[model samples]
Target: MTTTAPMKRRAILAFMLDRPGVLNKIAMLIRRKMYNVETLTVCKTTQPGTSRMTITLREDSDDKMRQVIKQIEKSTEVISARELDMNESFWREVAIVKLEADEGRLETLKRTYPFETLDSQGNGCFIVQVTGTSQLIDDFLKDAGSDSIIDVARSGFTAMEK
Candidate 1:
């Protein structure tokens, strides 16, 4: 009997030279590798000449992941590349979840979960602002399962480098 491994989601951070077309270089690499990037964030780093990029993807095997890592390292614009996981460090992501908690149940729902009213008007429901770790967000959503969820939007994982 053979056991198949599940696709593992990984967070990758890369420091690169700050210049035009830098982001394209990273995106192209992922595209070439046929890896599906779940979320990606790019911003200027403290160093004036450098920038940081964070990417999350699901991989089926470590071997292919390693190959992609090697490719990233070889890129002229990329200074360093790293793969991060929960055990190594703390990470968090922000998301905006909009749902209808019912007019009367608003108080009960807010008390049960961490939520801020974004908009409450003539609309049939309310918009809530939420920011936390992925697990926390998922738990909150699960608890709200009994209620009617109007909409959900997620800003994928934004991790802090070690």
Candidate 2:
């Protein structure tokens, strides 16, 4: 009989040179290592030619995480790569969901989920935006009901340790 280790989620933050194809290269590296990523967010940093990337991945052991970090940091474009814990961090994701309903039903939605108006197409269709943790956004979607959902656009997790 074979026993397999449990897969756990880990967040890795990388500060790298901001250049075209950097994200693609990093993703390819992870894939080459036979690992899959959960969510990845990349944005420019305060430095003129630098960017910060937060990657969520699932791995069976911490040793693999260290290997991935080493491979990432070895890249000329990558300045640093480190693992972070979400439990002691600040992170958020944004989602835009469209709900279809009459003004009365809209009130129910507003009360049920606190979202800002993104657009109102009229004829009982509207787009609303929610910005918060991924869990919070997911909870809002659950309470809003799938039947009422017209569309959904979500951003992945972006984070920093406190």
Compare the candidates by TM-score and give the number of the best one: 2
Candidate 1 structure quality by residue, lDDT tens digits, 113-144: 67788887545577777778787888777877
Q: How do all models score by TM-score?
A: 0.82, 0.89
Judged by lDDT against the true structure, how good is candidate 2? Answer: 0.89
Minimal lDDT window, size 10, model 2: 105-114
lDDT of candidate model 1 versus the reference: 0.81
lDDT of 2 by residue, 23-74 (tens): 9999999999998888999999999999999998888578889999999999
Model 1 ranges with Cα > 4 A deviation? 1-6, 122-124
Cα lDDT of all candidates, in order?
A: 0.81, 0.89
Candidate 2 root-mean-square deviation in Å? 2.8
